[model samples]
Target: MRKNLRVAAYAICVRDGHILLARSPADDGTPEWVLPGGGMEHGEHPHDTVVREVEEETGYRIEVTALLGVDSSRRTFPGRLLRRPADHHGVRLLYEGRIIGGDLRNEVNGSTDMAAWQDLDALAGLRRIRLVDAGLRLWRERPAEGRVQR
Candidate 1:
């Protein structure tokens, strides 16, 4: 099996009972909502990655305040070789962020199509990526180790 590893950062920004979210543009034509974040550039600090990614995806300048936690997950998917599978692992750092400035706008020709603040209570009914739930859990529980086991 082939192996792939991804290290990323994400932010949880909530205000007035609403949570900030970005709509990931899926090639499969399925709508997927996710927190504003993505893979970190090489040699970039996780804190810096969260701030940069949030701005790129949501068009909001964010100030990362707290390290919420890290979440890790692994999955297997079809590989390049016929009938073979690839192992994919993702390590995501979740952080508490506050919008410091910048007007709201959608990312242009990027991974996400739109950005909006959604009602937190209504999130359960929306089609979202797992990172949303993971980020929220870290925000809510705030484990001492700053890591969520999967």
Candidate 2:
């Protein structure tokens, strides 16, 4: 199997019983909601990456308040003919954030199509990315190690 690794940062911004979310563009023809974040750029700090990614995906300037936790996940993907399957590992940093400024707007032609504040109580009915649940768990549980076990 081919191996791949990725490091990303995400934010949990909840206010007024709503959670901030970005609607991911349908890669498999099924749109899913996710936290406002993405993979880090080369030479960038994870903190800076979260700020940049949140702004890009949600059109909101955020102040990172606390380190929620880190989450690690692995998956296998089918490869093309004559190639081995790909094994991917993702390490994600989840942070608590407060919206400080900027207006809400959809990211144009980005990984996510739209951003919105969703009712927390209604989340169970929504189609969402796994990261959403992971981030929320970190926010709620706040384990001492600051890492969620897969």
Candidate 3:
């Protein structure tokens, strides 16, 4: 049995009444918005991963201020796409970060299709960029010290 485990980090960058997010290219290249962060590389901690990913994706230097929550998601891969059965899964660590430096510049050599701030309330009206709602909820209501209730 081949089991794959991945650790990813995300930041809920909030200032004033807006939240910074990057539109992902994975959702059929349609640019779905999401928090500014990505997967942890080898030998890197989740905190450092979020800082690096946020800068890479949003072009803004941020520091992880607090740990919001942790979550796990899994999907079974059908044999049609691969030679054998496998699980596409992730363990996500959500963090609250504060922008310390750097200006908003959409890196031409980046993974995101777009990076911008969206009204916190207006998020519900738009077709969110995935995990944004969950991250925000966790940040707002700091649940226990384990995995989020949801």
Candidate 4:
């Protein structure tokens, strides 16, 4: 099987009773709620990646307050068009971020199409990516080993 890897950073920014979120098209082309960050650029630190991604997807300048934890996942894609099946491994860095500046706005010509502050109480009702759930666990639990329980 072919192997692929993606290392990304994401922020868990909560305020009052809301959490910052972005709307992105999922693998199936349906929009889902996700954290306000994304994949790292080549040679970029995970810290810098979170800051840059937050601004790009949410129109907010954020300062990462803490390194929350890391979430790792692996999935395999079926072969297509005579190509070999591929294994995709994703390494996600989760950070606690505080918004420092910028207005709320949707990303244009970017990974995400909308940005919003969603009520935490209603989060369970929203169709969201698994990363959102994993990020929240990392943020709230703050495990000493910097890993979330499966």
Candidate 5:
């Protein structure tokens, strides 16, 4: 089996009862909505990573106001192409962000195809990655230990 670890940062930006989200293609090639974030670049601070990712995916410059919490998940699956079992662990730092500048525009030549603000109440039917719900939970729960229970 192969083991992998991934660390990323995500922003929970909300205003007027809407949340900022980016649309990306999921593993099965379905369009899935997720928090505006991605894997960190080596030598990049997590704060800087979130700022850069939000701007790249949503075209909105933001300042990370606070670290809301951390969400970690682990899963094992059979590799489709490698013919091996794999373990993947993901850690995401969820931050509260405020949009300071820039315009809303679709990302070009990026992992996410577009960005949009969705109604918080309307999320139930939308196809989304688990990060979306996890980030939102952290934002709302604001646990003292900076972690949310499954």
Candidate 6:
């Protein structure tokens, strides 16, 4: 099996006691909630990627405060249905950011449905998409060092 790795960054944007989140444009149109960000561009810094992605997704320019943590997940795609082996993995760096400016709006034709501030308490009851809890916990703890264990 051949191994393929990808790197991306996500922003944990917060303001006024609420957190900023995006509803991803899933294949089935069942958008799932996820942090605002995406894959890194070649030769681009991770910090820059997070900032750029957040702005692109949420229409809010932000300032990255610190690296929250790193997360990894693996999946398999059927080789018979494709050209190569199925094993795929991702290394994602999560960062904490504060909005600097820009009115909040969804990017045109982006992979996100909408952007909004969900109260911290609402998180407990709302059926959030994957990575919401993880991002919130990291923001709450705001660890000085080390990565958050999944």
Best by lDDT: 4
Clashing pairs in 1: none
Clashes of 2: 0
lDDT of 4 by residue, 96-145 (tens): 99999999999999999999999999999999999899999988889998
Q: In model 2, which range of ten residues has the least summed lDDT?
A: 23-32
Q: Can you tell me which runs of candidate 1 are displaced by over 4 Å?
A: 80-84
TM-score of 4: 0.96
Tens digits of per-residue lDDT for model 2, 2-103:
999999999999999999999985667788899999999999999999999999998999999999999899999898789889999999999999999999
Looking at model 3, the pairs that clash are 33-129
- What TM-score does candidate 1 get on C-alpha atoms? 0.92
For candidate 6, write residues 7-29 as lDDT tens digits. 99999887788899887856467
RMSD per prediction, one decimal?
Answer: 1.9, 1.4, 1.9, 1.0, 1.1, 2.0
What are the clashing pairs of model 6?
none
In candidate 5 the C-alpha lDDT for residue 146 amounts to 93
After superposition of all CA atoms, the RMSD between model 1 and the true structure is 1.9
Residue 75 C-alpha lDDT in model 6: 84
Best by TM-score: 4
Query: For candidate 3, what is the TM-score?
Result: 0.89
- Each model's TM-score? 0.92, 0.94, 0.89, 0.96, 0.96, 0.87
Model 6 compared with the native: what TM-score?
0.87
Model 1 lDDT per residue over 8-123, tens place: 99999999989999998564789889999999999999999999999998889998889998888999987654756879899999999999999899999998999999999999
For model 3, residues 8-123, the per-residue Cα lDDT tens digits are 99999999999998887753566678788888999999999999998988889998899988878887765555567667788899999999999887757677767898899889
